[model samples]
Target: MFSGAQISLYPMTDDFVGVILGALGALDPYRDKLRIETDDISTLLVGPPEVLFPAMRDLFVAAAASGKHCVLSAAISRGCPGEPDDPICRSDAVGGPVGPLSLRKDAAIAAVREADVTGQPVAVQFSLYVMGTGDHMDEIYGCIDFLKQSGVFDRSKHFCSRLRGDAGAVFSTLNEAFCRFGPGAGHVTLDVTVSANSPTAI
Candidate 1:
């Protein structure tokens, strides 16, 4: 039932420090909604999808808006092993109500759309690992099937699929996967590594 994300931002520009700092600032407003911690390598955010996805969208949009070649890499996980099981990690943690999927999708889409307006399309690649289940492979394949039919997947990659399209659609697809594979009776952990950048940059 735990959900969290570890993210690292790399701005491919001379002003990398400034760009990264600005991107981090985008999460400031949501401090109350997330448990955020930052060190030299990356920032960790623990919270529900309602706040987490929007925060991610805003942070990426803010960073991409700099028009510098940048890459945002994230590890989003739920029910991880050997981790403290605290309220922040729990899906039922006391916070604002979770928003509808459509609303979350809209937020991500808007951010990506804003970036796309600058004439650059954002590209994202991610691998989802569903663990702790007896039929893990079956669940994984089921999820993959769902993604392929979901209309947001790139279809060119497998096992580790490459997602390419409007940012919002990509994020929405990701969010759905995360939710579906989260902690359950037979399922224990869902780990995802996501890397995003501008199409021309990478």
Candidate 2:
């Protein structure tokens, strides 16, 4: 599907050029996996969640590592609107691509398990929707349980059970949830919205 993120980075400092450059540079290594476009306002990254979320995690980590107050605003979406017949948006039942259903869930889980967010005040908020399933809420809760035990979740920040926490952990949790429920037997689609920022300068 057309999973991607439109991102804007703001650094709270006078000489912000280097911080911006460094943050962008962190994404350079993932160039092969993502389609990145930057302008005066924001950077658009189009790719699968497996690659996109981690890349975002690295980008935000790089920005936060600069020891400046940084805020990353992003809009994450999936599916190709107005192109319902497109293979990316259509399900396998209609002879569409099914790679997303079989995405490596273990890899995403491992990524989140390995991330360290100690002492980082990064905050992230995201909502995940698993569509076209009779047991959608069950699947959604299953994913939520996974995120809760991951240790990066800020339980107090939750509103309606949405997740918020360290950028890396949040991205990793998102990746896991997306892959696990994205293209499964009962799931035909998945939608996610995410916003991440560091409220306190490190």
Candidate 3:
């Protein structure tokens, strides 16, 4: 299996880079066959599927808790190691009546297993498209009523979400939320997972 990760460093602090490098070193033994290549605000991690997955999670959690604004992106290719599928984990958008997308239970457990074992925060991937339900004018917003009524909202720049929570809760809620759209309305396919995460520029 092959896995890759990308992270975005926030707050743009001088101390941030050194801290993450140190933490990742501490996690070396726990991380399965991990490697690093870094730039100014991002890092790249590539490694085995199982080990890379969790290592990425642990690294980001450590970096974030260390008092830095950090977000991550990652992908894991299971079995084939060379070929991987696109599975989105979390998505935020404005088109449909719905406000945001979250996970169900099935996807959550699998992603968490990778996070728990490797000690890295999870990575969520999402792509928006119609799901074959709802009104045509509804367009992107499948649940137009729900979007206006639901109090769920965030202030992030990307209409997508990357979260870390209880192994089960995070993935399950994301999956469930996106699929909630119906009857001709499109939905985003979420493939959230954990890997040996590094910053994109680093």
| Number of the top lDDT candidate | 1
Worst 10 residues of 3 by lDDT: 86-95
- Which candidate ranks first by TM-score, i.e. highest? 1
Q: Kindly state the number of residue pairs that clash in model 1.
A: 0
By lDDT, rank the candidates, best first: 1, 2, 3
- For candidate 1, the per-residue lDDT at 133 reads 55
State the lDDT of candidate 1 residue by residue for 1-202, as single tens digits.
4567888888878999999888778888888879988899988998876577667766877887787777778887666665666665545322234354445344434433333222324566666676665656755665666666555566546557666665556666666666654234222333343444545543
Query: TM-score of predicted model 2?
Result: 0.67
TM-score of each prediction: 0.75, 0.67, 0.41
lDDT of 2 by residue, 54-109 (tens): 78778877888888777777766565353222232332222233343223334446
* lDDT score for candidate 2 against the true structure: 0.61
**Can you tell me which runs of candidate 1 are displaced by over 4 Å?**
90-120, 182-202
> lDDT of all predictions, in order shown?
0.63, 0.61, 0.40
lDDT by residue for model 3 over 77-133, one digit each (tens)? 222323343222112221235433332223333433443232334344333334334
143 in model 2: Cα distance from truth in Å? Answer: 2.3
- Clashes (backbone N, CA, C under 3 Å), per candidate, total 0, 0, 54
Cα RMSD, each candidate = 5.9, 5.7, 10.6
